[model samples]
Target: MRRYCLAAFLLLVLAAPAHAQAPAASLPKVAVFDFELFDTSLQGETDGPRTDEHDRLLRAGDQIRKGLAESGRYAIVDIAPVNAAAHEKNLQACGGCDVQLAQQLGADLAVTGVVQKVSNLILNMNIYMRNARTGHIVASMSADLRGNTDESWTRTASWLLRNRLLAPDFGRPQ
Candidate 1:
């Protein structure tokens, strides 16, 4: 018993400073890209009805971006400037859109997503965050938002932020 207790105390004493000296982690700066719209085509047969679905997805993406940016953890840059700039550079999609361009415009991370239907009225999203300089996907998430309304938008945004940006391990040591 005495040997065990002494060993435990010595271990704790040695580990304390390492724990206390660990530097606080900083939140990575993120820029959100306009979400890709899939399942939202106003086709020959699905034209009229698809308009509502398309609009809902567009709004949801906007709301999610806004909510995530409100956290102040990310240096959120609007997609308008990025898109206009990308057009000038002849980049196709935002993800394939150049990281060097993004970094030169000042962003550490670039976030992009897609809003599509996984089921009836269930909007599913696949979001990705890439390290701008390295082009590595640092984080990714999938979520199902079942309806298109203010409430649904709010819920989806909250879930996205919690799971992707503010995850418990987000600021933790690897």
Candidate 2:
């Protein structure tokens, strides 16, 4: 009787859920959209060499897209190739900005972000995921890239990837 009871208890425990509430499944096929830059460059610094803000944002976006796709959590569809459609239509925000077009190309989700200057040497960014079918935002996150060091981009990529693999409510209340 004792052995049978112990076995039953163990079976029940093993079958129970680890968390009472968990998201159904991970969002797949995410596209990292363009990183919008809110320029805060000094106006009168003509003497100092100008950094191409647009190029930096594009590099960051590429880094994010590559990082997320490499994680195996998503099938990354490089929207850059199809960006001309958005430009022609002037569909900017990237969140429902091109859901119909994205669906046509067979992407399930899109990741978009913005890079803004909170202060000199401190850049703030918000990265988000959008569902292609419903055209709804599924997840969002923000991080600071400080001092333009190598670690800055690494941290940003890490945060973006973490949010993609793990459900939004995995670590906190939804």
Candidate 3:
């Protein structure tokens, strides 16, 4: 009878499920940089770069940061420090500068984008997400926009976030 009781206790212990661990308390941090503008519009007879276009690109960056933060999967790191560091390091257009900025800000991921305007009617918004530690691009998406207006740019960015960045399977190991 004693041996049977011991055997039953061992069997129950072996069949029981192991304890489940709690989820992480904090989300991963991401630093999103301003979307650079590469305007290729034909130089007018006497005109220069359009300041409005630059402003729109800057707004797009803010939109991206907000969108990612709202997703609840990541914590958006403040960009002011990253921008200051970039300026001090003269990191503009430098290779791996985005990653360097993210690392400095103690972020797990970094995002960078470019708005290429070929003309008033043709443009492209390209975004890249990289691992700050490895400096490897984890995701990339591009949207060919038809109009170079604020509404068109905003719409394109929203579509990219929905279809690529915030998709259900996004960030899963392939």
Candidate 4:
């Protein structure tokens, strides 16, 4: 009886690790593209694009990629292969082309974002994730940032990632 008990205990211990690894191994592969900015602010129209906002766009993309990867829910595939196409085309306005590019990268989901600036004080930041094969949006989140400063945008990205972006069953179809 003691030997049988020991055997069962070992089996349970070994099974625990295997079960734990299963979910992580099966996490969806996602390709996160660079974020784009649509500036409609007076500063942009008259004075032309601000260099600072361009840097912000780069940071926003990095933040999203890191957040998703650390969530243990997605495997972030590198989007470098399609970087040119991503930069040249407005992924949001291209009518499912983002999905096609992501699919070519062997990704299960395609992710992109945009920051629309109405002025120095008003901005809308949005992130989108779509099924690469189906070309259907599975998850999306947006934040309205009041200040155009880097701190506000960074904090908003962090908040959105923590609260809505990776929430329970965030993208899974109900």
Query: lDDT of each prediction vs. the true structure?
Result: 0.62, 0.63, 0.81, 0.87
Q: Give lDDT tens digits, candidate 4, residues 1-174.
A: 999999999998977755444365478888888889998888889998778888998898899899988877888899989889888999999989899999889998898899999999999999998988898889888999999999988998888888887888887532
How do these models rank on TM-score, best leading? 4, 3, 2, 1
What would the TM-scores of all predictions be?
Answer: 0.62, 0.62, 0.78, 0.86
- Candidate 3 per-residue lDDT, tens place, 6-27, comes to 9999998888765432233466
| Overall local distance difference test of candidate 2 | 0.63
lDDT by residue (37-145, candidate 2, tens digit) is 5546563143342366556667777887777656444566767667767545533453366677677667787666676664558877777666777877676677777
Q: So what's the TM-score on candidate 2?
A: 0.62
Name the 10 consecutive residues with the lowest summed lDDT in model 3.
Answer: 17-26
Instruction: Put the candidates in lDDT order, highest first.
Output: 4, 3, 2, 1
Instruction: Give the Cα-based TM-score of candidate 3 against the true structure.
Output: 0.78
Find the candidate with the highest lDDT and give its number. 4
Instruction: Give the Å error, residue 103, model 4.
Output: 0.6
Worst 10 residues of 4 by lDDT: 16-25
